[model samples]
Target: MRSGARAVLALGANVGHRAQTLHAAVEALGATDGITVEAVSTIVETAPVGAVPDQPDFLNAVVLVRTDLDPHALLAAAHAVEAGLGLDRSTKVPDGPRPIDVDVIAVGDLGDDVVLDEDGLVLPHPRAHERDFVLGPWAELDPDAVLPGAYGGRVVDLLTRLHHGEGPA
Candidate 1:
């Protein structure tokens, strides 16, 4: 059997029972094959980012999991959970409100960096560091968390930098 890889996942919900949706999503992730949720951050409320305005604020949280599934497989599992939670990708607007959103923040060490722009999956989420909704809760869960890639840095540092308007270097 292959050893499980440590992964970080960001969760958010803005429509219908936000907190409950986040909780259920975490539970669903734990119940998935080859995935075991080890830790979860406290959920925080934040205004939505990007386009698609005139929506409710979001409840966001982060989870750490040990998984035997590879990057793409894990992404598939996340999408499955979203589907089960009634997140219809077909009808949803880009960057719009949703019942649930799950993003693969990072996977394993990969030491240098892991870049995958194909197959609808991106490792070490391209914009994770820029979003406080992702970094804030993540920092609470793992103070020492360092994003795994070239643009990566300490989670808390990234959050601080963002707060100071420094952005990622």
Candidate 2:
């Protein structure tokens, strides 16, 4: 990432003081040097995505950021943010709700098929195409950045569909 490269981050949480966790995440990210939060969508409550549902709904939001840090560094910073807020790595259930969940949605101008996680950053998120928790709030910030072709629907359209259908928790 250069001086002007921007990335979108998707955040969600459903357990143990959710709203406060969201606030903490925003604060932590904002506090990280070389990173500036450009935009933030409203904190919306939605059901959890994927399985292992024995939990409550989540407060989800998307953050647009301008950073000079590379995608891998930014991802490390995000993980630090989560850990700073008390994320237990011991939890084995993947995608399962917790005190906080921060995901790298898109980085700079990366492609959908590209894998950033191997480089310590993930883009277009591995499961973003199937997640309303991420897509709904994400669309609020950068609807045009949504995937193309089969996923041509604007973020708003996806949000609407999710709200109208069985989505998020």
Residue ranges of candidate 2 with Cα displaced over 4 Å: 117-120, 148-154, 157-169
lDDT of each: 0.89, 0.75
What tens digits encode model 2's per-residue C-alpha lDDT throughout 46-154? Answer: 8766676677998988898898887888888988888887787676368686888888877766755566557645465656666776776777777676543234346
- Residue-level error in angstroms, candidate 1, position 83: 0.2
Candidate 2 CA-lDDT value: 0.75
Task: List runs of model 1 lying over 4 Å from the truth.
Answer: 111-113
lDDT of 1 at 32: 99
Please provide, for model 1 over 1-100, each residue's C-alpha lDDT reduced to its tens digit, 9 standing for 90 to 100. Answer: 4469999999999999999999999999999999999899999999988897789999999999999999999998999999999899889788899999
Could you tell me which 10 consecutive residues in candidate 2 have the lowest summed lDDT? Answer: 145-154
Give the clashing pairs for model 1. none
